[model samples]
Target: MSSLSILLVEDDTIEVMKLNRTISKLNLNHTVIEMKNGELALEYLNGDHKLPDIILLDLNMPKLNGIDFLSILKEDNELKHIPTIILTTSCNQKDLQECYNLGVTGYILKPLRYEEYVTKIEKIVAYWSINELIQKK
Candidate 1:
């Protein structure tokens, strides 16, 4: 499979480290672009940087949460088509409904165990890596 550029919008420092380790463990040849919040993510998306193949977003953040980002992204003509998947711990029905309303591609609940998290991330990476994606660049 071709290498993919992935955008990750998250706020937790430890989660970032864990995710990095998991990605390395999975041995997928993909580049991850990190942003601390949705506002920063939007800035990155609007900049000259290459568009990512997919986005892995967290729901709860300090500024510009995932739902807000999804609302903005899904309305944009240029960026709306990128597949966005939510990776979060929240199991609230409201969150799920809102994300679906905003057009997220998929929603994954973060597992408690490290092994489970790695396995979930592995599946996510593998799927997105092999799945045919629409290129905007």
Candidate 2:
């Protein structure tokens, strides 16, 4: 499979570290672009750099929360096509509904266990990767 590029918008340093290790262990050919908040993610997306294949976004952030970012992104025609997955600690039904309403492709709750987290991320990656394949056929 071709290398997948992902934009990860997360503010927690510990989660970031754990995700990095999990990615390495999974042996997936991927590149992760990190941003501390949704605002920085928007800047990167709007810049000249190539757009990532997918985005994993967190809900709570210091500047520009996930829902706000998703709202803005979905409104912009050029940016709306990119797939986004909400990876957040929030299990609130309202938040989940809002994310889906904003057009998020998937929503995953942050698992407390490392193994569980790895499994969830792998499943997400696998689905996105294979979904692209099926679409091309």
Candidate 3:
């Protein structure tokens, strides 16, 4: 599969490190851009940068939570097509329903075990890399 530019919107330092570590361990060449919060993520998205093929979003954040961010992103003309998946620890059914209602591509619960996390990330990257993604001009 071809390399994918991934935008990861998360706040926790350990979570960010864990994802990076997992990617490295998997030997995948996907490019990962880290954002501390959804606000930063939106700023990056609106700027003059190549849009990411997919987004891994965290539900809980300090500024602009994932659900709220997803709402704004979906309303946009240029950014609406980018596949967005929730990579969060929240198993709250309400949160799941709300995210689906707002139009997320997928929602994955962060596993407690490191092995499980690696497996999940591997699948996520592999799936998106093989899919035909849009290139916004």
Candidate 4:
């Protein structure tokens, strides 16, 4: 299997660190590209760089929020194919509905416990990896 590439757009330094540690501990056969804000993420996605298989997007960000980013992404022909997952602290139903409406593949609330967070991420990675393989087959 090819290593999965993940683009993570999160603004909080603490959250970023936690996610980085979780990914490292999981030892997932994936490459993670990190960005601090939605605008920067959009720039990266629009550039000549290879598109990530999955995007781990945070809802609240500077310059542009996840909903706005998703709206733009869904409209772009070149970027519409990539799957985006909302990984956020908010569990608001309205936000969830909005994300689904904007075509996010998944929505995961940030876990308060470190162990739970790692476990959740692992499951997400496993599911996506398997799903991709099945699609190819």
Candidate 5:
């Protein structure tokens, strides 16, 4: 299988580091395209580039938050079909409901333990890697 290209929209430096380490351990050779916030991510997406197979989004971000980002993404005809997963520390039911309503493919909480977090990420990547995704023209 070809390595999955991932777009990760996150602001926390430590979280990004941990995610990179976890992905490296999985040995999938996946390419991670990092963006500091939703606005920056949008810039990358709008530019002439290949769209990522999936998006890992964080709810808490400066400039444009995850909810707002999702809203914008879902509205765009060309970009709406890509699967977006929420990886956040937020346990709020409202946030969860909102994300689900906005069309998030999966919602995963950031566990307190590093091992647990890694495991969650591993499962997510594994599932997405094997599943067939619809390619938009």
Candidate 6:
């Protein structure tokens, strides 16, 4: 699979470190751009920087939560095509349904175990890296 440019919007420092460690351990050369909150992520996205291939979003945050961020993202014509996956701990059915309704590509519950998290991340990276994504001009 080709290396991917991943936009990870997460609030927890530990989770960020865990993801980076997992990626390094797997020896995947994907470029990760980290944002601590949805507001910061939006600011980055709106800037002149190149867009990421996929977005890994966490649901609960202090400012502009994932659902709100997703809502804003999907409404934008230039930014809507990027596949967004919810990498969250919430198992709320309403949250799941809402995300899908707003056109989220996937919803994955964060596992407690490190091994399980690694496995899930591996699969996620493998799948998205192989898929032909929409090329936003």
- For residues 1-137, could you state the per-residue lDDT of candidate 4 as single tens digits? 44678899999989888887888898767888999998999999999998888899999998999999999999999988788999999999999999999899899999899999999999888877777642562
lDDT of 3 by residue, 1-137 (tens): 78889999999999999999999999999889999998999999999999999999999999799999999999999998899999999999999999999999999999999999999999999998888663332
Q: lDDT tens digits, residues 1-137, model 6?
A: 78899999999999999999999999999999999999999999999999999999999998899999999999999999999999999999999999999999999999999999999999999998888773322
**Candidate 5: misplaced stretches above 4 Å?**
134-137
Off by over 4 Å in 4: 133-137
| Predicted structure 6: lDDT | 0.95
Clash tally for model 2: 0
Candidate 2 matches the true fold with a TM-score of 0.94
Q: Candidate 1: which stretches are off by over 4 Å?
A: 134-137
Give stretches of model 2 more than 4 Å off: 133-137
Give me candidate 1's TM-score against the actual structure: 0.95
TM-score, candidate number 5: 0.95
Query: Candidate 1 vs candidate 6: which has greater lDDT?
Result: 6
Supply candidate 6's per-residue lDDT for 1: 73
Clashes (candidate 5): 0
CA error at residue 85 for candidate 2, angstroms? 0.5
Collision pairs in model 3: none
| Higher-lDDT candidate of 3 and 6 | 6
Each prediction's RMSD to truth: 1.4, 1.8, 1.5, 1.8, 1.5, 1.4
**Between the candidate structures 5 and 6, which one is better when assessed by lDDT?**
6
lDDT of each residue in 1-137, candidate 2, tens digit only: 55678899999998788778888999988889999999999999999998888899999998799999999989989788888999988999999999998899899999988889999999988887777642452
Error of 1 at 39 (Å): 0.5
Judged by whole-model lDDT over C-alpha atoms, candidate 5 comes out at 0.91
